[model samples]
Target: MARAHRYTVEVTWTGNTGTGTSGYRDFSRDHEVRGDGKPVLPGSSDPAFRGDPGRYNPEELLVAALSQCHLLWFLHLAATAGVVVTGYTDRPEGTMTENADGAGEFTEVVLRPAVTVADPGMVDAVPGLHERAHQMCFIARSVNFPVHHQPSTSAADSAV
Candidate 1:
């Protein structure tokens, strides 16, 4: 939380076709995405769209960032609480629904994270750890959405 940075990406496109002929426009982030060729969407007629699938999508990146942030915070909290966490993994799923305001736009995203915590005595700490992680995660606190984390433990609850 010491400092943060801000970045902006501008996407612009231009197309020129006959009055009847179909026209297409291309888009690019401020900086070019590294790949086999210029980064363009696959659905488009452009065959040179070779950017990595996960890198070009902003929504995908947001979900990943939140999930990773939560995991890191959870690990730190567990360690401080004298919990021996051998490993952990989280699969965060995001759903993008239409904006409820009827503005023809998308609205808040829903994050459903399923975290697996591996530790002999850490099972009982899942609930508290999750709450702490949510509270401490910078990404979670920065955004306004329902980030639901459903945690699962490999050990029994009595182990802790």
Candidate 2:
């Protein structure tokens, strides 16, 4: 039997401006995402949809969720395999195509992770680990689009 997990969040729109969606361009897209015991995540639609550019958009959040899930799994696998990861950073990117009718979908997401290891022998294992990590990532598995990773690795060895 498969297991189940539950997750929840509260999204409250805060951009009434005294007039609530009175017109297409009248209301702001600003909102707050809150969960118990967590900091409220400020949110908005993409600026293209008349949202605040400074706030976090759902598109960006989806990409971030994918990247974060991959990172967490990668770290766990590296530690278990004794790869001794000393540092890690990811510059993930996603592409969303919008149709003329206004529907949109993310075509793909690329996870570009730069990983550093504590020893030279651990270097070889870093690149191959990304695939396994992606496979194990919950968010990556949940998404419809392909999630590809292009990872670069560095060893602490003074030779290079």
Best by TM-score: 2
TM-score of 1: 0.59
Let me know the TM-score candidate 2 reaches against the reference structure. 0.95
Question: After aligning candidate 1 to the native by TM-score, how far in Å is the CA of 98 from where it should be?
Answer: 3.6
Runs in model 1 lying further than 4 Å from the true structure: 1-54, 99-119, 156-160
RMSD in angstroms between candidate 2 and the native structure over all alpha carbons: 1.5
Error of 1 at 48 (Å): 17
**Clash number for candidate 2:** 0
**Candidate 1, residue 13: CA error in Å?**
11
State TM-scores per candidate: 0.59, 0.95
- Lowest-sum lDDT 10-residue window in model 1: 42-51
Supply candidate 1's per-residue lDDT for 38. 51
lDDT (Cα, 0-100) at 22 in candidate 1: 41
Candidate 2 per-residue lDDT, tens place, 13-53, comes to: 99998889899988999999999999999999999999999
